[model samples]
Target: MLIPAHFEDLPFDPQRPRAPRRQLRLESEGSTASGETARVLIHNISTTGLLIESAVTLAQDERIELALPEVGNTAAHVVWMSESFYGCRFETPLPASALGTLELFSRVISKAAPSESADTLPVRIARLRKEQGLTLEALAALVNVSKPTVWAWEQGKTRPTPERIAALAKLLGVNEDELLSGRDGNALAQALNQARQVVAEAFGVDPARVKVSIEL
Candidate 1:
């Protein structure tokens, strides 16, 4: 889980440490003044700015509007660029609540199955549904999907979208991590590596320069 930390006190001071940021993988859409919308992959986010990758060409200082979930359209300007990746500064910093929502959405979107899971994702979803005393129809209603869709998910014929996964995890009273990766400890190492890579790319530095330490 991501803790919402304030970034109001921190400015863009090169002499001081950067504001706290969270690594995430969120698929969202953005539009430029040309009214062309493109899919964007959000790599990480902070109150002040974010790192994103897209196939669409964006020049430095170019303004774009992102269709962020729950937060609606957010305006930002490109601050730097590296190949397909772009570092952007938000026109207005996100609030703590908005940051929390984005973090939750990111977790739901970026989950990967553990390599040695005892059960497959479909089996785990079915088991969790049963454990929650929910029928197929009941779960479908709760997740705002059709019964056939829920059945398909359980049958492994189809997978839920990231938004639906978030809703399903909440309805089943499970963390997104637990639902997707079975809460494997190895996931922590993977998460750290991903974080380091995101930070390194955002700053245009070597990944080795970005060290992550956990207090607990």
Candidate 2:
């Protein structure tokens, strides 16, 4: 469970210290663009703008819709984009009901530091490997890949192929889509891949497997 990170403390005065922006892992389920649902994580949020770290890539000015649990789907526009992180400004402010729910969730998160046990790519891969009782060597053999390849995935040094992810899903008893696309899919994944290429140089691994959202 990857918990979203939020700021601590709400100020009594309206101008007092507002809650720090929260980092949210959000899923955009259905929209006109993506026939299927999409998952995304919002790294930071403020009244004016939102910084999202998505597994997919989005074009500038792309129309995006987000589904907040209590808020339902809301519309936004992509104002900024890097390789992995994109910024969106809400087209219309959310309803009071939805804002209330978000406030409540933020308060709860503010009281506690983010739990490390929450969602992480490495943890996901480790759990999958453990559940399948497939040693790194075993999985490597199954995939007709080198042991280092399997090791890379486990260590967050690489990511596996969608094909391999499909196979691994069956072995680990998890959804193929979840494995192939940890949170973001479609365009988001494309953007994430581009970001990984730059970051991979420091890590000496393929951006595909060791992708921050998707495990190698």
Candidate 3:
């Protein structure tokens, strides 16, 4: 039987709590000692370590270098493994500045797990805009709309007309159907639910009584 483990359950000194991990989906590149590179998917990250999934064969205790966006190459060693997923501890914990950059990148690119939420229109718009390195103002200028209007569309406060959506799709390099479908709302909902559960467990309260809210 496969036993599930939480990061908090890992062996550690009781006085020093392990760093919290944030869920994210980021495509990154990793290379082994022999300099063979492979594409890897980052599932979650913390300053101290990361959980990654890759098809490249990796053994426990193997050292690898990961090319992190904005963070440059980081060295890590495999601490544990289950199938294609590997838990790696960084040789040096990420500095605060690098952690900030990684967090920003995560917020920009992290997608909801397919089982948790289908990619929504708002999610797609926000993701594509960030991926293209276009600010709201820049995208608005290209779409001939006010910056707030673009923000409203991304926040699901308002939606563009079919004509505007078609224009947006073209600008975003996707088709109309791809732009209009999939919702980001469910991703937020899932995160909120997870938060509530965690808080409830910490306080020994019912999840229903734990209200969670996120600003932006």
Per-residue lDDT tens digits for candidate 1, residues 136-211, read: 9999888877776686677564688889888888887777777787665467779999999999999999999999
The residue ranges of model 2 lying beyond 4 angstroms of the native Cα positions read 1-39, 95-97, 103-216
Maximum-TM-score candidate? 1
Candidate 1 runs further than 4 Å off: 1-37, 113-216
Candidate 3 lDDT over 28-127, as tens digits, reads: 2222343334445565678898876566667778666656556676778889875566789999998767666565544433343231244667778888
Native-to-model Cα distance after best TM-score fit, residue 122 in candidate 3, in Å? 22
Cα lDDT for residue 107, model 1? 59
Give the TM-score of each candidate: 0.36, 0.33, 0.35
Better of 1 and 2 by TM-score: 1
Candidate 2, residue 170: the lDDT equals 72
> Tens digit of lDDT per residue, candidate 2, span 113-133?
433475555567676787778
Best by lDDT: 1
Counted clashes in each candidate structure: 0, 18, 5
